[model samples]
Target chain A: MTSRERAEGPGDGIPGRAEGTGDGTPGRGERADAGVPERGERADVGVPGRAPVIERRLHPVTPLRRAWAPLAVLAGWAVHDPNAAQEQLARLTDTMLLLGIAVLVPAAGLYGFLSWWFTHYAVTDTELRIRTGLLFRRTAHIRLERVQAVDVSRPLLARVAGVAKLRIDVVGTDDKDELAFLSEREARALRAELLARAAGFAPETAREVGEAPAHVLLRVPPRELARSLVLTGATWGSLCAALVVPTLLWLFTENVWTVLVTALPLLGTAGASSVGRFVTEFDWTVSESPDGLRIDRGLLDRAHETVPPGRVQTVRIVEPLLWRWRGWVRVELDVAGSDNSVLVPVAPRAVAEAVLARVLPGASVPAGLSPVPRRARWCVPVWWRGHRLAVTGPVFAARSGLLCRRLSLVPHAKVQSVRLTQGPWERRWGLADVHVDTGAGKTVTARLRDAGEAGRLLAEQAERSRTGRRDAPPDRWMTAR
Target chain B: METGSLDGTGAPADQPVWRRLEPGLLRVRRLLLAVWAGVFAVAAGLLPGLFAGPAWAACALLPLVCAATCWRLLERNWRSWRYAERADDLLISRGVLWREETVVPYGRMQLVEVTSGPLERRFGLATVQLHTAAAATDATIPGLDPAEAERLRDRLTELGEARSAGL
Candidate 1:
């Protein structure tokens, strides 16, 4: 529906909360209620009557960044323009460029200015409400309880301008409710307050909007980044890009400068960005706070991600062929909100295990996991690669991979489905594979290859899944027990 | 119906009663494939800068090769397609050379959708899709009688609820 036809009257259903007003003001009694939770039990009291109350604008400097593209295009033309010989022709080109600049300046400037001017957002006790439109008004309301994660990011320009973008992702869908272009202070405050409130409850006077120091768990130093750069396969991408294109172009043009001139831009942009990203996340650190695990990493576009305890659906531990030799692996958490957030980019096995233990209390692969049936040797020749699985009372664990060892873990209460698949080769070998599905679509926690074991596992997992679904907490996937 | 051992690592456990898809599904698939081959033949034979081209002979042979391949594949695929419902899960096996068998548990099913396109409607066939939280667990049974598809959907939905009591 178009809000243009009939303006969507703001928050008529909100009890005692003001509408989506342009100014950042809560309802009359909301000030007493709007005190967002910071440190203590005060969050619970402020949550009940909460309605997205404060309406505010994005960063005022957004116009500069938004209008910069047209300016950059003009500069590129000035440097690259090859036809500037005749005075009359040059004047004609100059006039057109001048006219283009004139039209573009106001067009981009006004567009950015108008969009920022029209956008508005407020924090309700139970929801985050946003109304933004240049011509046709659109409003979005995100339920506080459903706000699984809130990340505050400051990119290169935003960092310089001291502004940040706040992204709030909910469960089930890929949609993220965003409120961008806020001052650093505003972004941090909104994130802490919103996360506190969304963690199922918020106190009336709970005051930290956090930013409190956390107990440091792990850190990635510059040395490790250098090591990772040399070890990680992504470096090959840069190698291919730098060499392959220039070589092909040399064959065609036969002029070495032509190759360098043509390929320089590609190399400069790709190499710089990738290197920047690597450096940005160079000094990575995982720490603990009252809210949960607070992650601080990144260089150019620095990101602060908060993952609450028990919020993860599954965890995947992978070791690349090279990393395996060094006994290193990466740990990623599959929270319902965003895609797999790397818990650790790369770490020693002991370090990863320690972090995993602390984040997931009472979680460990049960000893003496049942081995895959004997004939599985044919299906997976790397039998000695530690292809093992086990289902204890709380978690299900599967370990596999020859060059790279991977261990996938899912809690019993989180099992979504159990599947049994048999390929023609496996059928010929009288074998089949059983896989268990979870919230994270790409990561399978259990994959047991066997014929008889597949059937037994199918029946067993079916029962386990049924029980998990039956007793699952009423509140999404976050319930601890 | 064929029975097989359910022992671990080698053969499957107790066999299931196999049920084939609607016989008309084979005819439907053959007709669709024939039309595709016919299109290739007509395009090569009719459309041209000139019909007397170097590719003219090869183009004429395309339809025969395609039709033959289609016939063999369709027949083999028809024979390969079979499904069985166990006590708590459903098993489907298909593919001629790279055969695959998928077993879906009833308890984990989140949605059961019954759909039929215009062509299937004309042929009195429908498809039923069972969805679970895991994409791997999702399964589709096609070319069922409309009435049969409805019955299975209802049964699965009811069983799904009964089994999905936790979380």
Candidate 2:
């Protein structure tokens, strides 16, 4: 499944080898001159130092897959208004209707085909270069070391077509580059290749280690996931709104249809979100691999996400109100460059802690967090007991919220800044909140602490972050090994 | 001077040397507030005067009251803005009603930008912004002398490169 051997198939082009003199070309002469020490390992795997550059276009079925949505809409529009369709047909004659279909179908196909043809991606020795766009030739060369994670998502339409989309998340960038509509096999192979390279392995050894089978750690049952989704605050809030708004409207307007209309949208949104979450997290499974923790989920879309080591900025464990009775909680990760942060959609507390230990290496959610000062009760009358903080050797953990208890942990090495904030009321009470910021855009805040304690925490956390970063492991994990 | 040391050394000499924003910023803020107040006063006076009656022109006094209140508050807000340069991190404390103190370590600094708008340039003031990997660290020191702003930018950049760590 190595990219070099797979590129020999039809429709795949090795422009680097064909042209023989392009930029960053891994030619035989250069491979010999640039003698990396891993050459012997490459020979053991039957592959030499640097593999030939693998460059290929998107799947040929991409055009039809891309045009299907608009085609479906057109057909629906024509069937929806039969009178308008007949009137238009009568005005233009049956030949004109046929002519319009002939022109539109091919036009859409041609545009899709042209865009697909223009797009090409190449995996080089140092970087993965994606050259896209027609009129504006935009090329993104993401360095291999900066590649954070690779996600493969299969939308329903693309899944039916037996193709998938690959999203590459790079460090320090907000937008992810995607290669849409590749054969499922090809996408998986490409993803493994990218991950292996990002882990600092030579192409030959990358194939050997990348293809190693991962151990399945945990899988959430479909019933448990649906139960957890229903138990969320959002679901309960929307359910209450759906019932109350219609009742209030019925009292005022006294119109059944008006009440029905208002209630339908509210009920529909709540139902759709619940069903969407269930579908997206149906077969949620977390696996432990040498590269990192791999999450494979989805009933319909089927997304495979990898959270590489050192990329997670923070971890959040949420125990919703109802889930507390069932002793289930959801673990979310603030991973750099990836938005799908759910480590475990729903798991027991013990299971979640095990998974957390795997992802963060040495960090865990502390059981005994120091509660806020008693004076804080003036500000948060009810929830002051829930707000607590703990500073451990590897991570800083903060707990907040009474109804839905949230425990957020930020690794000391990953802390970006520390802040202390005091409001007017807090000033009177001599209380402040300490916030620990990370690159993942989540802050772990210790709320309603003594002003002096907050100041000391802020200063100590800064110093800990400095020493933590100094003692942290190297970014390139495989190279360090 | 705040007598507490942010370094946790508990030494008086180690206490942070807090520096205040330039006094010129007060004048600049006052002038800008006056300009907005004038515009609002005209709009309030003319719009209602034309629509309702000439008697509604008295509504223009509302903006004057608000502007005067803000004028007095601006002085305290300006006085509240102060920053301290520590051995390892930069501390910025500001806000009148809500006191916010931010500590940005030198190793975490990604980019330091010096910007001066038209009005700020006219008043000989520049703003220095420090960016880290985290977006929540909104650390900005506004209303500094141009030379000091430049010096800060250069020093921060040099320190950032020397101590930069991977995110």
Candidate 3:
């Protein structure tokens, strides 16, 4: 059977009618009064104030094609034993059984090939229409206005072929599936068209950086990448193993091809990891675009993701121990309705601090808020006390900064959970660590060079944790419960 | 644990008595878990053997392993598990090595579902699951008396409805 039939037909459990509209026709509800313009007639003209919902043709993966794969596998298996001519002749002895599989092999293949051939998509001034089917034909209709976020990802193979996949996620619609697997050119065009539609076509008003813009933030350089390779344990170990082990193995076999296949993915992984470190170390940038903030990273993919600032629910800044010496911090933002967190892998101390300031301006901890005062506290675990710490008179503090260091303020309103940690090594050095998590997942962590102050801080924060709310109250509204 | 008398005021006349866990039941649960673990280890070791080498003894061990995994997961900390209604939330604390404490505040609870699997039904026990907006954050307090589970469910539902109406 055809993929559309499989997608829409009885067994799949998805009902016949499409997403929003009750009937097979596209326009229903208030959309009927929307006065959707006819295709190609002054394509830009619709309701004067609002952007027109351009209906474009989108093609989805065919079920016929998905089902054809198994048949192709069986066919390939049957003819795979080329050296055994007698066996091949004997394979035909089971003619009745073979006929059933062989007939499906060609029939399904022809159907899949024909379905792909006929699939066509076009975005008109009014709506997006995708029509594909072999026998039981169907169309997928999506109103351009409802689209929420557009994500584009290209595998290495797709990159070589100059083809990328596009996914258009829409809000308040149960279409069961979004747009996927479009060629790179087609994907870019779709993104641009939808973004333009969302922005409502005020040409000069469009943000310089947005979902449609190709401008990127982080790019990796070579020298920094090599340094990062030596620093990263995983990368360093693999490279050393690659150089030494292969030389020993080469004595057994002169063949270089066997060594190459095994070495390439590992070398590529180490190089990619080193490049990631380079991007994190140097040329880190996050800039405000008209639509949202554009985050760019990677040496290869050179990805650009636009996060609408309004959607941001929480901001997190993390400084793990290894990264502290290099003065690097990772920043992550949590947005509403999304399960995934958006992150900037590596930012210089100043850039990370600035980004945190913009995203979480309320994260200023009052100096006197803590009952016990401590000088420059390091946000390290107690087990990691070999790191430096600073103390001023009565207060115990540990200070660590990869580059530029800033203290995180978890206003009483934001505090969620407070935890204290210590290990055998920490006990030996008289050090203790304290971590206070806010409702936004932002943590104000301090590893005291002196154990006494870390204990006091942990005790004080635990008392505050009882009243921490889901959202940080405004500074003006901060109240002690 | 002491049962407190209710007063006309919100607070009870007397606080409920809290006791240390009964040691004998705790030991029994630990013994059961140990057996379950032993079964699981044997099963995991045999799974790869099924695909590569067909040993009848290893194949025979599969069912026992599956049963042990399910049994251990169901009643890992049977006796030490406790549920107490604090000022705001219902707290569930259990487990031995990796202890867990989950607080289901009345306002955040979406629904309270009390379910009984066959083994639970045979034991006359019920589990109340408090679903929240986030799937991962939901809490299930297992092995409660049937009547108590129903009462807790009623209280949670009433509070949830009141909170939804901005009370």
Candidate 4:
């Protein structure tokens, strides 16, 4: 069966596969039965089983997709410097120009083609092995059980070419393995299979796991996204600097050109960044599937990110000063191994809370957090009142920032370490600060507590973390179920 | 020195028995400081002497005085450094004026490294660095006997593996 599929061939010259392998091929005979056959049979449906050894190269359009960036850059440079282009063209004869194009274009294409040809990925029962590199010859074997998350991202060029890239993030590793330029449907299928395998599912049920029905939880409209972006502190700060600084300069120097020159770039940068956020976060949707939370976002470069169960390290709910009036807040999750961590770009307070509840069950931002000691006001006079913290049964939460209120939550099971620090001034005031760290960079810090209270909290939190880990579900969540 | 015992626990097991860094660390530190002080004193005296007169060579006294002050400060700082091995976690306390106490659980340890630089090796000293998933965790116990450092690494690694929990 594997040889037959191999003979069927890859890079079929079609930019994308229409439909060779849809679903429901019981290739379970070759499956290595690790365990849990009962649950596998119950859950397995419409899943295309994997052969004993499945190996294939990336799509044919990968070369073209890879070449698009440099070609576009060259075109942009030529357009920007028309005089330079014309001068260079005039110096060369027609034959020389043709020869140059012939040599350069093929050379670039050949390089892309060779790199693509050398890249081969294979999936066995236990691991996904990728072999690439033309000269050095490197091979990466990622254990299926260690797969953390699989992301399918389509940049503008790849989207146009009807292909996508699959980025595989594994446990305890910073580097991501990527399979560049697969047909969109194939990428989705592969992602599902990999995630299922990671979750300890049999090969017969892996494909169906990807097709599990998802319920839409929240969707941010384009209008709300625009309004939220405009209200952000960065936008306001940039606007004020662009307008106020230049106006002051004009008043002092009385030069209109200088003001224009100074303000243009600042205004351009601010406007560009805001628009970039808008483009990236457009049509942001959060949906809950059996596998995990599915975040499908972006306009120009669509990305489908799956945050598997038990992977969220911390959740942050931020309400900017201006956003408070509109009752809008942004919810961000510190998901392990994923950079696009914004769970919801903008939502109402209640909606954001609801989404948080979905992401981290039995967790919420508690009301009436214990405020810092009054004497600690010497450190941060204005924001000390807002620096509050609470320890719930499931999570430890800290609230800070008077101008922009932020509530950071870390699950007890996710606490990596605890720290209690006291500066000279804080010690003088008989106060200390407590920090609860997670795998992600964000930490929940309870600042300016009584030193004794801080010590007790540290000990209690360590105990809680121990119990939490003892009771926490295993990495293979499906098997536990 | 037992400033922050949790819950005022009376049990000796509950109370952390803090251990101080090796006394040899102070000697190594003083030697390192002396070398730096000599280099700075020479630069101060020679640079000004080249531009001005030999009278400016008195500036050499400035680094010596500063080094003297730091010599006392280094002892206090070194004395301030201490660590305790608890049931589930390790507690490291340091800093003279601004005290910091870090609690890292065995389950959270990702890597533990034992390293000895040339000077440290010359003095037969090593440092044990503990790493967790959190990058903010700066847990280092400097200036231990080389044999002790290895033992700590092995014991920590064993505990970490036994209690390993995913992030």
Q: DockQ of candidates 1 onward, in order?
A: 0.20, 0.32, 0.08, 0.32
Which is the winner by lDDT between candidate 3 and candidate 4?
A: 4
The residue-by-residue lDDT of candidate 1 on A326-424, one tens digit each, is 777889777665643788887888898888876665776566767766766676676544677877766777887766667788876566666666766
lDDT of 2 by residue, A359-416 (tens): 8887877878998888788999988989989999999999989988999998899998
**Pick by DockQ: 1 or 2, better one:** 2
Chain B alone vs. reference chain B, TM-score for every model: 0.83, 0.88, 0.57, 0.90
lDDT of candidate 3 at residue A204, scale 0 to 100: 37
Best by TM-score: 4
TM-score of each prediction:
0.73, 0.84, 0.53, 0.86
Which sequence of candidate numbers ranks them by TM-score, best first? 4, 2, 1, 3
Taking the tens digit of each residue's C-alpha lDDT, what string does model 3 give over A117-178? 54434453334555555565655554443333445655445566566655443332343343
Model 4 residue A116 lDDT score: 80
> Between candidates 1 and 4, which one is better according to lDDT?
4
Misplaced by over 4 Å in model 4 are A1-51, A72-90, A171-176, A208-210, A240-265, B1-13
- Of the true contacts between chains A and B, what fraction does model 3 have? 0.00
Q: Which ten residues in a row have the lowest lDDT in candidate 1 chain B?
A: B1-10
- Candidate 4 clashes between residue pairs 3 or more apart in a chain or in different chains: none
